[model samples]
Target: MIKNSYIPIPVKVDKIRFETEDKLIKTFDLVFMDKEEEKAFRYYPGQFAELSILGKGESPIGIASSPTESGFLRFTVMKVGVVTTALHNFDEGAIMGVRGPLGNWYPIEEMKGKNVVIVGGGFAFTTLRSLLIYMLDKKNRKNYGEITCIYGARTPGLLCYRDELKEWEKRKDMSLYQCIDWKFGAEGPIEEAAVEGWEPINLKEPSKTKIKKDIKKFTAFVPQLVSAVKPGAKDSYAIVCGPPIMIKFTIPVLTELGFPPERIINSLENRMKCGIGKCGRCNIGPKYVCKDGPVFSLKELEKLPKEY
Candidate 1:
């Protein structure tokens, strides 16, 4: 009974939580303004929606909250463009437009019963957070193998979902390795100082928090954490999302650890005008990122042209 794919439904920003210290990245909690529409909006964990602010523009943003957390949807936006800036400026209770659950999701069926390795950095961590949460839910955890996550940011302050990450760290069901590229006065990640074994990764000045052991003091590149963890690739799928440099290095390591191309998944993004397949900007070879992807297993990706 839902109508057109291009028509956006009006929603109200339920709340806004700044995920980072600089406030560049924010998590907006959203709910449909219409109760009927809200009850009907259903999206998978790795899917995305076209978020619009009318004159500003409509942009494709991934759904950050898992379906397991059902009452509302969440989108984490980094202020990088006119549309995103508009989203960040909106106050709680502000009305906005959304059109989606568009784009293919992470192959949850393929991931079932398999170990999962989630790797991400910067703002690209959004969808990965969704996938992780869905997999870790009590009803779903038994359906999967061991879950490991390697997440990083440039500095201590830039990591997303720290509160959830902290709670995830406390759970015995999953393993979380959090690191940073560097802190103050470092040329590069401290792990660069040694070719083998993990360095202390300590901060120059200790954290003021009196928890006896603080999470922020840890320092290393995202790849370095992957190297140290060296997750078993025999029955595992590695889902990686990050900037070009990080993805370039991380893939080789995952391969070296024994994961085949088929078992590695990559989330791709391209310039999107219309979230539906109508507009050609999101096209890559024969596929449209907004429709066919945003999530692709490496085997599926290898068959496509390299232009993307």
Candidate 2:
């Protein structure tokens, strides 16, 4: 067991809303009840928070909203188990406990003036969203080179932030590509209703659609995607977050595209009992994942055990 020393702060949930059709995932917008606490709160991209629902227990969740937006903080959560399911039902005006804006942040400062490529899948994209917004903010936009995002999901309906993706698509300065694994027509009624307003309707019928079982196909697409975004080597960065399999194949493709090991950033997911280092559950060797990093360069991660 780990020792606990930090005091839990009371935060008022200003709003709670569904981000996906999956009843499991939800977004919470919160503010510290005490104005002083709000003033003191600060965090960088890729950090996480320890949230507790009184008797229900606590879980580590990434701070999904960007720091560029002040006055409040936000978290995107997916209900994978008991505690998360209980948290999903929480709503506006509810009171929850919070412990930290913990963990290492992405090397945003080091990435300045470099082209950025972000690849994400499923809910893991939550933290990546913050990094994307931080780079796109009006004042910071010029500090980074061209931005490209490639996001995928098990299916179209499972994708989060429908409205936000649309906004990203309209930005001329950035490039965004979204893909789904299964063919849409395979679903009966849901497919018909869901496609009513969605764009780039490229998903083929079940019979014609090519199921992407080959890992090589994914690796092959990475360079093509990055080439379309930033054609030259020069200064560039790549950030990837998603299921383990995606990371396994994507890294090689990035290296082939000329991004050095140090230029690639990744976030490791684990059973984080406490968002801060106080909990030993997320320790990776001598480093506490919740403290030293959830985000790290490939070079830094090479030293960790394969357990994560």
Q: Model 1, range 1-308, lDDT digits (tens) per residue?
A: 67788788998899999999888999999988888897778788678999989888898889999999977889999999999998999999999999987888887888899999999988899999999999988899998999988888877678898898779889888888776766455565554342222234323312221212323224566765676667899789999998878888888879888999999999989989788898888887899998889888888888999877
Q: Write the per-residue lDDT of candidate 2 for residues 51-132, one digit (tens) a residue.
A: 8788888888888889998878888888877777877877788888777777888888999988888888888888899999
* Cα-based TM-score, every candidate: 0.89, 0.84
Candidate 2 residue 45 Cα shift, in angstroms, is 0.7
lDDT of 2 at 252: 72
The positional error of residue 22 in candidate 2, measured at the CA in angstroms, is 2.4
- Which ten contiguous residues of candidate 2 have the minimum total lDDT? 213-222
In order, candidate lDDTs are: 0.82, 0.74
lDDT measured at residue 134 in model 2 versus the true structure, 0 to 100: 94
- Runs with alpha carbons beyond 4 Å of true place in candidate 1: 185-218
Best by lDDT: 1
Cα miss at 99, model 1 (Å)?
0.6
